[model samples]
Target: MSADPGSPSAAQVELDGVERVFHLGDSDVHALRDLHLRIGAGEYVAVMGPSGSGKSTLLNILGLLDRPNGGRYRLEGRDVTTLSLEEQAQVRSRRIGFVFQSFHLVPRLTAAENIGLPMMLAGIAPRERAERVARALKDYGLEDRARHKPDELSGGQRQRVAIARATIMAPALILADEPTGNLDRSTGVEVVRLLEALNARGVTLIVVTHDPQLGARARRRLLMEDGAIKHDTMAAETV
Candidate 1:
């Protein structure tokens, strides 16, 4: 990575000739069509579109949660389209982090436990997990709430916990889908700021959102409609 964030080098994620079709009873629903995208490290990009514009479908493919019916996808220079499901899962765990509209915190787990869940799943040592979890709690201002379960936290706090968990593994790419959708405007702004700060540190940030104001804040914007990219632009100031 270079000091210039926008300069293209080895892409974090790439899609070429990507097409996604879904079977709806008998008819085929085209969700994404011939989409080509390259996201470089440290870039802050936003994907925007109305409902049924294939935004979520595109995101699913980027996160390796779904496969395109046709085309190729490369993640960190590896041709991921050829990997098995288990292999894809490993790659996703190692390189990608996701935050959804809903906080998606485990209702049964405390904030600290939820933040440490990824490390736990990867079989990290108890001592190291405790150390990392402690840092995450303080970094995200959740130290005081570490013992609070999801039901005990506010909406903003829950989202913060989710963000903390998502970044715990230090993934190369963070894919956020309406990360602030469920929060109030002020809280949403705060969450967005946190995500931007992460991007400033060279973590690739790709956000999908229906809010135009939120989308425009990104350095680069991609608009999708009818299962294809309708417009792609980089802010003049970003260049």
Candidate 2:
């Protein structure tokens, strides 16, 4: 889809003085220190960093999997840091999508069942759930593999299933952690193209990757060190 001319370029994610600290014995390890960031809707952002630089920590906080010891996180103009555990879960389920390095599909479930997990947890009716799952299977090129388990699908197919599951709820923000890390170069490229297609459709895409090649594809790149954003720059039309 083409960009919407009238769509407002507004802040979708806002972070201010965000701090995360892990206490180990008597020592406190600062994972994120006074981090401040703002991301606009429909923006494709990539985060690159070395190991132990708190890349995972940032992603965890953004996904609401971990809480900051200090500061505020405002999503779509509402503060989420203060929300209770259940309240935060509700927001995370509806407003955010997560794609991990591992294809976290249930081994016991079929491809179609895995893709429809979110709606099932959300308590959607059986008929509508079946219809949406059918469309998702076709949309993600898993129609023939609908009844197959994760072990039965190829690596790319597994990642595709994971992607389908992530976006099934139509979340506004997608947090991808090393999405292509598990695939070969060729298959990784295919997986990335699928992600880019979703970004083009106006979802906010943030990818955390160690591969410079993958990071360069994003319009904006963020370099992290010591849990802080060291560099933020715009790349050329490398996509």
Candidate 3:
């Protein structure tokens, strides 16, 4: 289903009978099986499951980083399952933001340059890129560290820079995978609060985490097992 154009939310995602299979040496492993899901715009959702339960696979599919072997995916009301590689890349660049546990920032680039990388890759003009990067750095409380490279920053600082870069594109959806896995308890809390703030501002946020404390903070939760959703908090709530 599509989001209302006049609504404050910006994106909607739907998956119908999606399946993903990987070939091992002589056997096939199903990573996702007939998984059907819908995420409305501006929702805060946590995906929780044990290792090999398909949490990361699900995130990859939603972020357009991987294609499903069966079924269809619709994002913002358009069937994106069949888009060409170039088309998918275009859509991913403009519409999706991702935060990883390792804080995937360029080791050689300074914070400002890293934050501006997406715009640069998209061929945005230098002046506009600089302006937006500056705003993001300030917004993420990394203004003072803009000139610092990743190695020079602390774990928390590096994560802040990563978050800034992720959001610089103003993406309709933000996907975070173990976003706080490398930080201390306090720092992790700080990082999650930052993500939550973005969600509060109407960005769709989906997080994959093993931390029950962190998962509990989401408005809705999905429990995955054997490549399918075993429980959905929203569905239970409605019933």
Per-candidate TM vs. native?
A: 0.94, 0.95, 0.94
Q: Compare candidates 1 and 2 on lDDT and give the better one.
A: 2
Query: lDDT per prediction?
Result: 0.86, 0.88, 0.88
Flag clash pairs in model 2: none
Ranking by lDDT: 3, 2, 1
- The candidate scoring highest on lDDT is 3
Provide the lDDT at 57 for model 3: 97
* lDDT (10s digit) by residue, model 2, range 1-239: 11121222222899999999999999989999999999898889999999988899999999999999999999888999999999999988877888888999999999999988988998888888788788878888889999999999999999999988888777888899999999999999989998888887878999999999999999999999998999999987856
Candidate 3 pairs with clashing backbones: none
Better of 2 and 3 by TM-score: 2
Candidate 3: residue 183 lDDT (0-100): 99
Q: Per-residue lDDT for 6-104 in model 3, tens only?
A: 223457999999999999999999999999999998889999999999999999999999999999999999899999999999999888989999998
User: Lowest summed lDDT over 10 consecutive residues: which window, candidate 3?
Assistant: 1-10
Which segments of model 1 are wrong by more than 4 Å?
A: 1-11
What's the true lDDT of residue 100 in model 1? 92
